[model samples]
Structures are given as C-alpha cells and as structure tokens.
Target: MSRIFKVAVIGGGIGRAHIAEGYSARPDLFEVVVLCDIDPVRLGNVGKQFGIARQVASFDEVLAMPDIDIIDICTPPSLHLEQCLAALAAGKHVVCEKPLVGSLAEVDRLIAAAHGAKGRLMPIFQYRFGNGLQKARHIIQQGLAGKPYLATIETAWNRDAAYYSVPWRGRFATELGGALLGHAIHAHDLLSYLMGPVASVFARTATLVNPIEVEDTATASLEMANGALASLSVTLGSARELSRLRLCFEHVTFQSALEPYAPANDPWHIIPNSKAAATAIDAALADWRFVPSRFAGLFAAMHTALVDGSELPVTLQDARNSLELVTALYHSAEQRLPVDLPLRPDHPAYGSWLPEPFRG
Candidate 1:
C-alpha cells in the first residue's frame, strides 16, 4: 500500500479551498493534519468549518510538526517564497498557489532550493487540470490537431473598488501585479500550455479601473516558438465576466466554454476543418478519460505523482515558462518595445517586474 501524505495548510483564506480539495476530496490519499493562519478568528473559523482539530497561529509550528508531510501554501504572494523555502528546508513537500513568486529571479532561487531539498515543490496551475483542456491537450499531443496557426485568448472580469478593498488586492508589493500578473496569468498559462512557448511579446497596459497603482487592463501580441501567432487581452473593467480561448489549427479549431472561472472544465467545441478531420478528432477523443476538474484534479494528479514517482502534472519549468511570459509582457509594455523569450538574469525586470514606484 502506498503511503498517505499528511497535509498542513497555511493561510485560512484560500487555504479553506485547499483543505476541501486536498483533504475532504481525497481522504484516501491525503490527511489534513493541521491548519495555520495569522488571523486567529479566521483560522479558528476555517478549522471548525472543516472539522480540522489542530490549528496553529504560526507557520513555524506547522514546520515543526513531524507528522505533517506536506505544507500547502495559500497565503498572500509576499509570504509564498518564504513559506515555500522554509517548508522545503524542513523536509516537507509543498503545494503553492499561483503567481508562484514575485519575479523571475525569485523563481530561479526557489528552483535551486527545490533541487537541493529533500522535499519537492508543486506550483498550482489548476486551470490546466480541467477535463475539457485535458482532452484538448490529448488531441494536440496525439497529432490530431495538426500544426497550430493562431490563438485568441481573453481574460475579462469586473473588479471595482469593493473588490480591491482587501489591503493587498491592488498593491504590487503584496498582490505582486495587476490584471496581467494576478488576474489573467492562468489564461496566459493555458495559452502557452496549448500552443507551447512564446517567442516574443509586445504589449500595452492601462490603469483604467479602480484607481489602483497597477494596471487593470492590458493587451499583448505573441509569437509562439512553433511559429504560431497569438493575441492576449485582459481587463478587470468588463461589464460581463468571461474567460475565452480560440485556437485555430491546420486541421481543426478549438473553442473553450465561456466559463468565467472554470473555462477549462468542459463543453468545449472542437470543430474540424473537414469531415475527414472531424473523424480523426472524434477518434482521438473517444479514448479520453475524465479527470476531476480544478483543485481536486490537481491534488489527485499530485497524489499519483508523489506515490508512483512519476513526473508532476505541473512542473517547475512550466512555472518558469509562465513567468518568462509575464516578465516579457511587462518589459514590452514598459519599454514600448517587443521583448524576446528566455529572459535571463541580466534582464532589467529579472529582480522585479513592477515599475519603479510600484517596486516598493
């Protein structure tokens, strides 16, 4: 029998969801042993709500628990790197929420730390785990989608002053970034996941909504490594919220559901260019097996990878690639020039992507 991992979730806000997916959703694979948060009230509330008997106010307590095999980080962006480093050093496997680190340099540092640590780190990109997106990935990997041509991706959602009322929501120091980094990152990640690496990016940004310090709207054009062209647009000012993706390949065109949050879940339209092509797509999808969607699916895959010693469903390099695009988009928009791929340590935005005033 495989060993069941014991988990300690930190930060009670988003951590509540992690408890639901990691512990409640897969009891056989994971045991929710502890909960940690800075706020006693919120922590107690979440612990009682989830029936988690053990609760602690300090992350140090979480790290010191010998029974806790995994440290699930659902904290603010500012605390992620520190918590991840400490958890890994304590010989605990880690699962962290998105916008992994604030900058490319921090990501590099975490990658190096992960290599030397006894434990492994898995960054969450739950959108990639959805059934519909998985089917799309299978079709493309099986060579049924043919050569990619173009992709149009949009992450449009409304966020007014009330949404940013949370102290960290709009600040670069805490939230890390505005719409491009925080809001649309998952959509951009899905784009790269489907089409592969981006070769270059040219973008423009605006602070048209909610008088925030960071941009609330942005647009960018991308050239994929495979020679495919793509465009990305993001806004927190839209009247109607939607996350959409349209991919046009040589053999078929794939359109995702208009789900604002769970766009990759299901009910996608996979249209072929011809009747023969349609047959091929149908054959490819016939072999598709359903996986649980969102956080549950991510945790399930992680459980398999940890127990079976298989490759992670999402990798550190995948996180790096996503951050590379984020860096490029910021560099492009700030410089008013197209930025190229593989941003290195020498890049101006390597240490931090935020502009001068926002860097503090």
Candidate 2:
C-alpha cells in the first residue's frame, strides 16, 4: 500500500459530498488536507464538520499548499475549467465534476493541461461505477445481448422553481446548461460508455417546462458507431422523479432503475429472445453484489492510479467523447440538422452556445 496523499477539496455544496466520501472510506489512502470555497461561512462550516485543519477562500490557496496531491472540484460548471487548469499547472491531479468543463474547447484545454503536466484528470461520471450500470456493462461486454440494437434513456426528475433559486443553478453562463448538462449527464455518459461513440445526433431543447434561463427538457436521437440507435430524453418537468435505462439487443433486453447509487441491489429485468440467454443472465446476476457508492469506488480507483501508476477510471478521451455528444446536441439543435461526431475546432458550437432569443 502507498502512503496516504494529501487532497484539497474545492466548492462546498456537492463538493462536500465528495469530501465526505473521501474522509469516510479512504482515510488510509487520502486525507482532506484543505477545503476552499468562495463563501467563507461555507468553508468554515465544512472545514469544522469534516475536521479539516485548513480552510481557504480561494482554490489557489489550496493549490499553494505543497502537500496537496489532488484538487477535487465540486464547483459549478462554469468554473470547472479554470480551477482544473490551475490545479494541473500547479502539478496536482484533478477530479472534476461531470459535464467536464462547459464546452468542448474547455474540455480540450484541460486535456492538454493534463498531458503537459503528466497528471491525471478524471471527470465525475459516477454512474458508470454503480453496481446496476456495471452489471449492464458486464452484460454488454460478455455478448449475452449480442450487438445492441436500441437504447432508450429516461431522465425524468423534478426540479422546482425553488431549486433554481440559488445563484448559477439554471443559467447557461454558470450552470453551463440545463437538465441535459447537469442532471442527465450521468445517463448520457453511461449511454456513451455502453453503446460506444455516437456517430451523429439530432436534438431539440425547450424551456417551456421551467422558467430558468436554460432548457429544462430535451430529446435526442443518436446513431452509434455500430449502427445501434438510441433515444435520450431529459426532463426536469416530470411530475414524478424516476430514471431508467433500457437496452434492447438481438438476443436480450436489460433494464434498470436509478437504484439510489446502489445499482447492484436494484432489480433489473433481463428478458431474452430465448430461454438460454435468460438462464445465463440469471446465473451472471446471481453472483452480483451491489457496490455502495459509484463516487466512492471511482475515487478508490483514482487513488490506485495515482499511487500505483495504474489506469484512471475516467480518462481524458472518455471526457472528450462525453463532450462530443454535448457538442453534437447543441449543434443539431442550432442548425436543425443532424450533426456528426468528431467535432472540429471550427464547429460553431465549439466554444459557446446560446439559443436565438438568448444569443447576444
């Protein structure tokens, strides 16, 4: 086992969740050496609660600490790139939250920074580490389902007006984008993870459901690399909160719910075209056990990678693929035409995107 490395956590809202996960399970591998937030009160409160010795007002303060090994960014979407780049420049690894950086260009820049520093940068796509999702990945990998034919994702979660009342919650400039950017990112990442790279995308977004500055609902049609088709729907206007992913292949169909972060414990239906595949799937799942939290597991993997020079759980190219989907979605919505993958730097939506009325 390697020595416990020092870590500094940025932001305080959901960043606190990462801190809690870090301090709770992996004290032998990691120690929360510092906590930083723009809000001093929040910094103080989190520091006290987490038994942290150092609380600073800026991420730079945390970065300046010689002992810090990783900078865990739980900050808003808008600030991810800035903090991540700074951390890399200062010779620290980064664990940034989902939607990586706001735009494809920012994602590229962070990737470049990590390359130059020879440091690892991981995006928080925790859903991939969940037991339920992992089981789905296993099913796909083992070819029990044959080649996937279709994927349907439903991210129907409620986010009332009060939820967006906090600063930078629903705005394009800060929160980056809406449900697709914030809430459904995990589902989207999973879709890409399981199905492989999307060849093209067509999407439509609307703000009819919420009064926020960004769209609260969207529907996207995806064509995968292997000719599989996928339909993704994101809505913060759902009357009830539920998340589900259904994948149908030639041999079998698998479906699983949100599973409250413990995907293995969740009930998954694996219906088959024939009974033999069903028997195989049943035997496979019988040995399955739920992993507690996706974030925790991934963090543990990241720790191993940092300490043992192992593989990163989430890679820069993976982040690029996730950002590619977002880039395609925004472009397809803007041009009202299907946009292809491998977006170029010259793409109109590469840097920033805004709807007609909102575009300055």
Candidate 3:
C-alpha cells in the first residue's frame, strides 16, 4: 500500500480545483490536511466544500506546519517564486502554477535553489496528461510518426472586462502577461511537450480584445529544433472558444479535440498516410492505459513519482521552457524581429519580460 501524502493548498481559487480533482480522486495516494488563503471568506468556502477541517488565513502558518508533506502554491504569478522557494526550504514538496516566475533569471535562480533543497518542485502543466494527447505522445515516442512536419496550435477563448476586473489581472505588473502567458501557456507547453523545443520565434501581440494594458491577441511563427515549423495563434476575444493542436508528421497527422479547456481529451482526429502506418499506430496504442484528464491524472503521476523517486511529470525546467518561449515571443513582438531560443543571461529580457513602463 502506498503511504498517503499530506498536502497544504494555498490560494483558494484554482487551488480548490486541485483539491477537488487531484487529491480527492486518489484518496489512497493523497490527503488535503490544510487549506490556506488570505481571504477568509474564500478559505472558509473552499475548506467547507472540500471537507478540510484545518484552515489557515496565513501562509506563514501553513509553512510552519510540520505534518504537511506537500505545499501546493496556486497563488498569483508574482507570489510563486517566493512561496515555492520557501516551501522547498521548509522541506516540503511544492507544486506551482504556470508562468512560474516573472523572468528567465528568476526561473534559473529557482532551478539552482531546487538543486540544494530537500523537497522536490513540480510545475503544473496538467493539459499534457489527457488520453488523446498521451496516445499521440506514445505514437511519436515509438517512432511510428516518422519525422516531424508542420503543426498549427490555436488558443482562442473569451475573456471579458469582468474577468480582468480582478485587481491583479490585465496588467504586466501582476498578471505578468496577457493571453500568451495566462491562457495559451498550456497550449504552448503542449507544443513543446510533443513537437520538441523551439529554435526561434517571430511574434506579434495586440490588446484589441479588452481595454487593458496587456495584449489579448497574438500570432507567432516558430521553428522547432527538429526543423519542423509551427504557427501559433492566440486570442481571448473568440466568440466560439477553442484550444487545438494539429500536428502533421511525415507518416501521420494528429489533431486534438476542439474542447476549449480540455482539448487533450479523446476524439482526436488521427490520420495515417498508409495502411502500414495505421497498423503500426494501432499496435502502438494496443496496450494504452487510462490517463485521466487534467488534475486527477497529473496528481496520480506525481504521487508515483514521489514514492518511487522517479522524475517529476512536470519539472522546473519545463516551466523554464514555457517561460523562455514567452520571453522570446514578447521580445520578438516588441522588436519586430525574430528571436532565437534558449535565451541566455545576456538577453535584455532575461531579467524581466515586461515592457519598459511595466517593469518596476
């Protein structure tokens, strides 16, 4: 029997979903011992809904607790670096949300700190765990997909003024970025997850959707490391929401479902160029196991990783890859030029990707 891991979840917003779908799904693997939120109202509501008897209003209190084995930081983008580092310092495993930190430099710092810390850090990219996406990943891994070709990734979702009315959003200082960082990040991460690393990026971003400081629409051209090209289009103004990935490989083409939030779910349109290719794809997925969508699947994998000392499903480096792409996209848009990947310390935006006015 696997020993249940105790978790303390901070930030009652997305944190609640993590508790509901993740910890609740695997009662044998995890237990939500505490729920922490600065807002007492939110804390009480989420705590009561989840049946978590222990509730705390302060982060310091959560940190000081000795029984909590994992600290899940679902707080805002700005708080992630500090909160995650502190949790690691307290010898507690950490799971943080997207746009892990403000800058590439900060991500590097956390990467360095993680090396010496007692607890492991796992970044959230739950979209990568869906069954349809997993099968595509398996097919590619088995070399049934042959060489990579072109791919089109799209993230078009609605976000009105009310959504940005939250105090921290729609500004570079708080939200860190617009749709690219907050919404489409998961889709972009999926791009890297299956298609491999990006070699260069040429992007253009605009704020035409909402009357806010940050951009809501964007388009980017990418050169994958394996010599494949990809086009990324993102907009928060879509009337009909969609999150889709269509990958055209040398032997087959894989397309995700049009579901906005859970595009990785089944019904993916997978087309093989030949009978032999179709047979190979079938053989590859013959023994495919269930991969629960979103948080449930991610947490199960995390539990196994924690117990058996395996590599985390999503590591800080994966966060780095996501952020580096964001940085390059921002830089390219601002400079009106294509930017190369694997940004170094010497890059101007290495410290912070915010436009000049937004950087504090």
Candidate 4:
C-alpha cells in the first residue's frame, strides 16, 4: 500500500483545520484534495488559505471524485449520518467528528453499512492520541496503575450569545445536543477511554448559561463496568476556561494539564500511592513511545491501520459506546433517575434523544 491517501473535507468551519492538519502535519500520509461547503465565500476563502484548488458546494461532487480515498466529515451533526452512508457507498473510507450520530439506531445502521463497504469508518477521537493519555494507558495496561478507583472530569468553558450566533450552535436538531454532546464530549470520552466502559449514569442538566434549547450545564455520576466510580461536570459558563481530568487508581493518580482546548497533550502529573509505586511508574514510562497528538496522530494511526490491515485507530464500536453514554445521560436527566447501560431500541430515548419539539 502507498503511504499517502487523498482526502476531501466537507463543511468549511472545522473542515479548514482538518485540511491544515493533513497538509501541514503529515503530508506523506494525507493529501487534502477537495473542500466542500454550501457557503461559496467561506469555501473559497478556506480553499485559498489552504491552497486547495478544488472547492465545491455539493457533497456529491466529493463523492464522485475517483482519486479521493477518504472523506472527512466536519459538517454539522444533522448531516453526519447521510454523509457517512454516502461516502462508504462510494467506496471511500471516512473520518467523522464527535457525537457520531443523534441516535443509537443511526449508529447501528452505519455499522451495518460499514461492514459491506470496501473502506472503513473511523470516528475522530483525537484527544485520545495525546502522549500524556497514551502514557497513562500504557501504565494501566502494564498493571502499574493497579485497580481503578475513582475519576473526576471537568469541562468548564465559556460560550456566550455571540458564540451561538452561528445558525446551528444552540439548537438541538442542527447541532444534535448541547454542552454534554458538543462541548464536553471529548472530556467524557477521555474519561471512558481511561477508566473503561460505563455501566450506568445518573445526570442533571440545565440551560442556565445561555438561551439555547439544549443544556449548557450538566453533571453526571458514572459507574464503570469494572466497579470504578466517576463524576463528570460540564458547563459553558466558566470565568476561567479549562478541561481537567483526574483519575485515581489503587496505585497512582493521573492529573492532566488545565489547557482548555488541548488538555491531553502534556505536562501530566502522575502521583503514586507509595514510593515503590512511583519507582514502578517511572520504570514503566521510561520505555513509552510518543505519538503526535490530535489530527496528525489520528491520521498517522489510520495510515498504519490501512497499510497493515489492522484495526482503525478509533472504531465504530467506540463511537457507539460514546453515543450510548450520551443517550443514557440525557435519559437520566429527563426522567430524574439513574439509567443503566446497553440501552436497547425498546428504550424510550433510543430512537431520538432530543426532547419534545426538538425531536424533528
């Protein structure tokens, strides 16, 4: 297999960042061949900024391009399912942003479509690629962290009326969900990535920060499948913005940097339970190999997976797991009760998680 894969980016907003990461960071692995968006001015501006000659308004144009090997879907959440299905049908691999789809049924359908496609669907959970998190995972895998005990994840950031001026920002149908789905998703996903699958969740949500229909503040208590306990707090109303994660195990406690956007990158403080544990952690991490964080790292891993016929860096199942937690959280908040894991189709919120009038 060749080392390089051609890519087409849909949606101009976050699509510009994906293009830059592909072309600037790992040129040998990815080529940004096309850019698509409904807005001509924004599309042309992004194309010129990135030196991309092909700028089109229709996604079909991207799907029809024979040389594009992958489609990076940076579009709004409402468009993700249809776009992913179309790309897979066109025999191109896909990389999608978070909150993969609005409902569990969509995830199931996408999983089935992926099974028959020539290429695979990879959900973008780039925060999981950072060296700090990777090092933490390594320590845990080596049994140096010991049995997990507790974790606290906080996503405290500010998003005001101006931030939601964009057409889709504050709505449930267009952006899918609010603070829990869009803003705090990465932090929550990182929580599950480090701790393990969540067995249940009891949550509370509010829209106090903004006039948006969706919740801008939320808190959830989680029970991991392995008997670990965790708490997640999220809001778009913080005076000092930050994303923080603290995982405490039997042997050591891992604390991440307070960087609001790239908390997973570095400067993690790993506190050991005892002197012997500290020595062991130092010995284990001494042999750790670093992977570039965010999009670059995700693309590199995708290249290796494609070439070696191995698993994609982030699988569809991973997306489903994240979405399940999302569904459970919303259910718990809406019903004022704790919800169990493995939410089935028969569940009240399985088909659509949006409440009332927003269930369009």
Top-scoring candidate (TM-score)? 3
lDDT-better candidate, 1 vs 2: 1
Q: Residue by residue across 77-139, what tens digits does model 3's lDDT show?
A: 999999988999998999998879999999999999999988999999999988899899999
lDDT of 1 by residue, 109-165 (tens): 999999999888999888887788888888899898889999999999999888889
Worst 10 residues of 3 by lDDT: 282-291
* TM-score of every candidate relative to the true structure: 0.97, 0.92, 0.99, 0.97
Number of residue pairs clashing in candidate 2, backbone atoms closer than 3 angstroms, sequence gap of 3 or more or interchain = 1
Q: Candidate 1 or 3, higher TM-score?
A: 3
Per-prediction tally of clashes: 0, 1, 0, 0
- Candidate 2 per-residue C-alpha lDDT over 245-324 given as tens digits, one digit per residue, 9 for 90 to 100: 88888888878765533333356676788888888787777877765456677888788788888778888888888877
lDDT, model 4: 0.89
Question: Candidate 4 has what TM-score?
Answer: 0.97
Q: What lDDT does the true structure give each of the candidates? A: 0.89, 0.80, 0.93, 0.89
Runs of candidate 3 with Cα error greater than 4 angstroms are none
Clashing pairs in 2: 132-263
Best of the candidates, lDDT: 3
lDDT of 4 by residue, 275-340 (tens): 999999899877678878777788888889988889998999989999999999998999999999
